[model samples]
Target: MASVNEESVRKIIQYVGGKNNIKAGTHCVTRLRLVLDDESKVDKENLDKVDLVKGFFSANGQFQVVIGQGTVDKVYDVFIRLTGLGEATKQEVKDVAAEKGNWLQRGIKVLADIFIPILPAIVTAGLLMGINNILANPGIFFKNQSIVQVYPQWDGFANIIFVIANAAFTFLPVLIGWSAVRRFGGSPLLGIVLGLILVHPDLQNAYGLAQARSEGTVPVWNLFGLEVEKVGYQGQVLPVLFASYVLAKIDVFLRRHVPDNFQLLVVGPVALLVTGFLAFLFIGPVTMILANWITEGLVGLFDIAPIIGGAVYGFLYSILVITGMHHLFLAVDLQLIGSTNSTFLWPILALCNIAQGTAAFAIFFVARQAKMKGLALTSSISAWLGVTEPAIFGVNLRYRYPFFASIISAGIGGAFISVLGVKATSIGIGGLPGILSIIPQYWGAFAIGMAIVLVLPFLLTWVFSKFSKKKTEAELQ
Candidate 1:
């Protein structure tokens, strides 16, 4: 551990162009989000060579360094100290990175913590609903009334899993917020409380989103005739989070100051009410507006020239998914669900991602080295299921050819899907399975787009890899 601190941390910072080059940083379960001032200054090849840096991305003005979870905080700490960020101010105290607890081990731990625990919730709901669609409509799966009766076709036990799945994704902000608070030196439970308030069923029902839309502002309740308007907060990351962060700091400060005799009564209640109210009124709305603005901008782009824009979007989209920047697009799903009960982005994204995976799969089939082939196979399988970090970071980024092939293939697929004007009927899963999201209506067109994404890239990559291998053999001969 001491050796890792002295050696890896310094080398990583130097290779990434020193701490001065870093613009900002935020850690996720397996990576560090860095914004670099001059990306050109960093030696990507050298950085990749580092055992600690698993992968990285430099695009759209964001530079990300993938160091898994254990190293994230150490890297974050080194980053903050070097960058002089997260300082305690009069109104806000910056949260420092918590103690390191085995990065590689914790990186997997965090992934398991986020994914393994929640995957059954996602897969069960998705598969059941998808199967139900095939069965109830009669033809895809045996056309049996008993089957429909057992599963109930529409209102059966499947909904329980579906609820878990949809709820997990829909209110993912709370999960992230809870983790963020835990990372940021606050009570994870308190952050969950703040997140729940925003996403809670009671709060949602009391807020009366239907009335709010009709009246342009629904009254949450007439608090001293203040008329608190309910605003939607599902899947929102910033508002309640920011409010909680502020409250946590405030709570800490109050703990330091308020008289011991009356601290519990005055500070506790005031902190809760003040933070909760401010969260809904100020923090929630402001961040929601910002999130909305980002969504509107992206949606507007698609509406303008889906083909060209989608091509650009598809190319970057693959990179975004790999780097975790795709969360920005998830915000659009929230708005789409509210407006049309459908999200148009996922199908396009799914196809592009599948195309990249297909390319990786092709590479897996063709690569000469046993090591490369194994890496390609592992990553390709992961990509097939929609997790592209391994494919992109492990194989494509290192090999060079597959990487460019993926980008090109994604661009072609994106352009084709955009021109088709395909869209998803509802917010559902993504990756190959997400093709179902476009079912019953645009299935044919969606299939065409999906075919293009899945087939073209796979065939192209096979040809490219085969040609490269022949050239290499010829050179050796």
Candidate 2:
């Protein structure tokens, strides 16, 4: 509701050590996360004193300033206008900021950048799948028979729902290919075409290919005397990602060397043909093998010690969210569900989100300032609806102790879920609504786990706030 003007934007820029000091700037749901060339140039004391600034913190090499929800967009627009950094994408900002990190951090940043744009599609599909599961679940409404079985006429409708739910995941490579190529500064259309080639109708559907392979019924094509298995890329993340990267590099190289007159004709066809072969022959298989190995390793680890695994994952999950690297889990979780029909990770992740929300709610009750209380209440609701950034940046991270309390509480809940062997059949909206994603048989355990996540974090943070020195709204600045 707070409107930012040109003067306000100027003040913000001045307090952040002027436009020259800002390496890159971007906005998330409620914060303007900036990468500064020099952190010390940021007048934290004065910047915090700026009007409409809710809070400030540094995490994952980015200096983040909370500007509340809708207000951030207006402020970001003015900030960009004043700084003359016109219409920069979040991924572009991340790429600029990523210069400070080592190889691993940069690599993770790249993966997150590529995947974040496609998350809404995946999350939506997951939620749809959850709803379909509910409809089809015999244990729920249909007494020993699914909804379709009870009403044979509804089979076509169920089939339509299934297609709607799986469309994104079934063609996930196309999305990833587009995003990855764009990230690599290559042609997105070419990347999409390459993705289409990977999942061509002639190829065996990826989900069914495993069974077909076991039955020795998979078709193979002879390409230059090399026998190439015709397998589609479905619900695959890493293979497409790797293939896109190769495509991007090749495209860029071709663009640089190829004559301008022949660029359009030569660049696309050559790049696609070469990348297509490389993708199917080398990149796809190699990355898929690597992805499977990683998935299996994590599954094995969880199987070996589910409690410890869940606790550790639950604790670190939020930390990953803070670093903006949690999008990497989308692929992993999808792969897990594809192979196992369920994943132990999503249930724990749901608990972690609820824990953060509960901690924020505790802050709402205890905060002396009306503004902080309002922020806490609003952020808590957002967290409960499966978005945690507001709660994390606005309340938990600001007070510090509330965040640790959440991690502890979430870890406990995670351990409990692991002991019960509760798993999610789909990766849907998190928090309270996330229970829909859990396998019907584990709903009871999930509810209990959710209760622990809610109650323990609230109590811990509330008790801790009483003893810890309270920072007044003024002192918080």
Candidate 3:
């Protein structure tokens, strides 16, 4: 492998149009996300000339630079140092807004990018809670009751761990906002601040948690005497994210217009503080309410007819996976909004994720190019652990038909799940292990979902791959 150095990354950045054109710099398991000012600004041929840069692509309005595995981080570091901003550094928040895909698809991809990394943490916490429930009930496991009784202190420690673990999900909006602002070239701290406001104690009680934690008092927000009702903003994104972008733009404008002498003291602090409050009091809550309504409307469709719901969701889910927006669903799960508490998404997502990985693995088996084979296999392994970016972007997406096959398999299986009325009582991360989140009664359905996800894609790849081979052979001939 070519050694990644400052000059290489700088050249990569310059080829992609330099610091001014960059909105944000982020990395997945195998690639770097660059929110560019203009897709045309990126010179793909020049970028590929660099030994370290594997490839560059533009889809869904985001320009992605594939660096492969550990290289992404190094490249991201160089990009950040050259620009003086990082994914978590919100101060330089740039507008990452892109006009691509439908609003729903875009929204899903945004959610997935922010949430995928934290998924294992979310699942582990949920599972620990579930297991704790089982252990707490002595009668269910009387055969092992003695072990539990002897470990009373262990229970308290376990509870503490669960609470802390769950906190990551509870406060996900802040995490996402931080990253989002950085991507947009704004202040990540602003995002974090906005996130805190959403999940603030006062707001948490506004919707319902107050009653859960206190007396029968649900905190209500009185907006100009129009008593708008809502709950805590834990794990929310729309409000804070929207606010961050708005604030970033406003901040940039102020810094440019105001005199340098008084800008810091007068313009900087005031702009951020005032805009942030306006966002928290009005923008955040209002937008969240709107998102809730949209989600409810969609869920209502599912209630009205499961088949349409299943097909639409499955189809969209597959699309979202490729663009990286699926994490938005988890915020609902964490906050007990939408179908989050119902475990409906995991089985479908799991199958799709697994299908893509399996297809990529097959490519490794048959690929003529030694380098392509290596990338395919490395990505395949990561996909098994629920980190599908490597597989999706590095392998499957490169060979378009594999991605199509995965999407088709996901839809078929997801449709079957919807027909069976198969739903989970709890949410877990998506992957093979995510199968554990299935309620015991739905074990058969889970198995079927897995079968379709795993088997269908392999079959599709088998059928389609012959053409890939023939094409290669014909070219060689």
Task: Return the top candidate by lDDT.
Answer: 2
Whole-model Cα lDDT of every candidate shown, in order = 0.62, 0.83, 0.65
- Give the number of the best model, judged by TM-score: 2
Q: Over the stretch 1-477, how does candidate 1's per-residue lDDT look in tens digits? A: 432454676777788788787655666665666666677898876776577675676533346676655767676676666667563321121111111224543333333333333345434545555554554444344443434554665555545645654565566556655665555555667667766767766555322465656776554767786766565576554565477677677667776888999887876576667778887767876876775676677678888888887689777887665544565555455456444445667777777667767777877667665545655676676676777776776667655567778777778777877777777644446667776666444567777777777777778776666667765343212
Clashes of each: 1, 0, 21
Model 1: how large is the Cα RMSD against the reference?
A: 8.9
TM-score of 2: 0.90
Q: In angstroms, how far off is 235's CA in candidate 2?
A: 1.5
Off by over 4 Å in 1: 1-154, 169-173, 200-212, 215-217, 223-225, 235-238, 255-268, 321-324, 330-340, 421-430, 436-443, 463-477
lDDT of 3 by residue, 284-327 (tens): 66886776776677567667787777766776775675554666
Worst 10 residues of 1 by lDDT: 90-99
Worst 10 residues of 2 by lDDT: 468-477
Tens-place lDDT per residue, model 2, 357-390, is 9999998888876667777898899898888877
- In model 3, what is the error at residue 203, expressed in angstroms? 4.6
